[model samples]
Target: MKLLFIALAFIGVAVRFAVFVSPIHEFASQRVEFSVPTNSWRRVSEGLFLYGIGVDPYLGDTFHETPFCLGLLSKLHRVNPLIIDILFPVADILAAILLYLFAQNFLEQKVVEEHKVKTSFKKESQILMLSFDCIRTVPKLVVLCYLCNPLTVGSCWAKTTTVFTNLLMAAMLLSASQGACRFYRYISLVFLALCTYQTFYYGLLFPALHLYFENFAGSKTHCRSRGDSVFGLLMDGLVFIGSFAIMLVVSSHIMGSWTFLRGVYGFLISAPDLTPNIGLYWYFFTEMFEQFRSFFIWVFLINICIYSIPVSVKLRHHPMFALFTLLPLITAFKPYPSYGDIGLYLSLFAVWRHLIPQMRQTLIVSVMLVLAATVFPVLWKLWLEVGSANANFIYAITLVLATSQVFFVTDVMLAHEKREWHLKHGVETVDKTGKRLELHLQ
Candidate 1:
């Protein structure tokens, strides 16, 4: 298994490097699907140029990255420009490896939990339990899915900063899964802080992470009371807040001011740059009336964040699944989303393979996604290069992508619920009287 992973990693790196050296990468970087105003490598290069000449890159509208990212990129460029190119593929490979590790640990814990709860499940449902062979194989398949995904490859070739964010998220998940280790919990919180520092909306992940810690604690030792669980949550929350505060203070010190607040988080919220991307925000805000802009901005921001509460509550027993569901929601509604964000969550679908049999919209959602990908570049060229199409052309595709994502998320959630019902009851849908029973998820 180790050898298989190493080989897969090698091939993944080779594929990314091949794309890097090819002419396709230049075009990939310019694609609207991969490069948004906030994450574009071209924008980053412009920011670095301005910074090198002792000018504030954030003063203008060209740069929207955090000071930490800017400083890190500047140092890497100084060491060797080649290192900058190499870092993208390495980041992607590392994220995949971290996800693989997370899946393994999660599945192990899942098996243990299932064993303990099997007595409560109907005898007929025993067959629905995960097989040892399935547990052993799923992690490798997850790694393969992530490493070979075209969106993941495109993001790496484009050199978007979302790759780094995905890496931090994967590390956070892996650390959070190892709930028995105090050090891993601290590491997880710190990574979560970094993710929030880089992208403000990622702060919503705090609830899911807190629940994961609580679930792990409860599983490891059943003696802990509700008071103990609440105390643990408080400590974790404080650690996360402290880590975030330190990042902000250090970032301010690095830039000699707090201008990045407006540049990074402010830009995300205000949607000031209307550069077309594969997100719903740019188009809607571009056409929004001036007086109503603030109202709708608040509405949209709330819409993006409000799902975390219910999703966390509903998936309390399955915090990892909660995290996975939230990722798609973030990607769908975020202000300046790119293909990297989509790829991140799509890769994680492998972690829930058990629910695949229960999903009903698989074929329809797959078609919508493929169609959106195929037409994005065509519409962009027709609008920009040929002048035959318009902004509506691009906006239409964004809607298609967003709708497909919504369908996919809801489908997965329903599948999870159905599977749980079957486990507690029986896989057979007929009643004792031999009449078909109806199961509905509200």
Candidate 2:
């Protein structure tokens, strides 16, 4: 454990030093430039520049970050940009540590639950399950995975604000999963609210995470009455909404007006930027009929939420796995999806390493991510710069990327269902005909 923390610090400094020394500095040499997405780091810097010179950041479409982010970056005007560069790696490190703590705590809870159901688990099945020593080291394992992953390193190298959002999200997870005080759960809600304030899509997470919070906060000794649970959730919802509202108000006050409400969020909901990226949105919308764009935009946004609510309800009992499933959905469907989002979810997958063995097409999904990330720049250059290929060429790769990610989401959900079936009935999952049931991907 001591050596793991040492390695963690080393990784933090190493990423910072590498970012400083590499040409990826200032988004040059990096294919995924920050300017392409809404609320990008470069855009915030642009906003901060305007704010420093007595102009509003929301005065134009160039910046889409919340005034809170702009205000946070405004502090950078006082310090060197290199300091902010160092800060991102530090955020990554902190987030890694938080995720480690959260995973360890979650695993401990699972161990306790498993003990209560020990009789149901068969002997061989229990042998294949996580060992006590392995459980103890899960934190280090999860943290090391995050630190060593290319997606995480790439996102940190790109200097996107996602590292900060990830940090907040990780903290919320840690707080909600651990700690005993009544106030701890509310603190987690505050962080969740802040996360939604920073990124709109996280608002959908409210139901799932609140479900997690209820499960975490509920007592095993006694069943709370239905009316009490409803009242508690209602009050928590108010807190979440109230905190988010206060955050928005504070952000607006910081920017001196509500103008940012449009510039930042409007750009997010409406896909005005047709810049090529890993997502499915840019290419389709780029060629879409301009007259019907509005309808389709709503359709796409609704499409993102459509599964979230129903899935949240159906899989509400398995909050962690349900959240895990939703992640790749976000990576697939977000209007401004990026590899950074993939990294965020992949880190969660690491925390839930028990699910990996159940996932079908692991090798295919891994290959798909590598191919997608590696080929995008080359194909993009061929189509946009070299002019030998048409938009369909790169769009095909985007299709591959989206399809692979959606497949992963489904695979994980199926894996979770399989695991639950085995746990409840027995390790031997068989049909009524007495044949072993295999998890088949559709």
Worst 10 residues of 1 by lDDT: 127-136
TM, every model: 0.96, 0.93
TM-score of structure candidate 1: 0.96
Q: Write the per-residue lDDT of candidate 1 for residues 1-442, one digit (tens) a residue.
A: 7897778867876888886558877988989899888889999999999988888888899899889999999999999998999898999999999999998988888887788889999998888787667577888888888898889889999899989999999999899888668899889999999999888888898898888888877767978898998898889989999999999899889888888888888899999888888898888878888899999999999999999989998899887789889988988998888888888888888888888888999999999999999999999999999999999999999999999999999999999988888999788788789997766666
Clash count, candidate 2: 0
Model 2 lDDT-worst window of ten: 27-36
lDDT of 2: 0.77
Q: List ranges where model 2 is wrong by over 4 Å.
A: 1-13, 27-30, 33-35, 431-433, 438-442
Model 2, span 1-442: residue lDDT tens: 6786668757754865587677765553245523356636677677778899999867777888777777776787577776787788889888988988998887787777677777877665675355566566777777877777667777777777887888998998888887545587789889989888878888787778777767755645267678877987897899899999999888877877889888878878897988777778888898899998999999999999887777787788877667767878876888887776787788778666777777787889879877877787788788878998878888888888888888788777777776766666667777899898776544
lDDT of 1 at 364: 93
Query: Clashing residue pairs, candidate 2?
Result: none
**Candidate No. with top TM-score:** 1
Q: Which RMSD values do the candidates have, in order?
A: 1.8, 2.4
Error of 2 at 77 (Å): 1.7
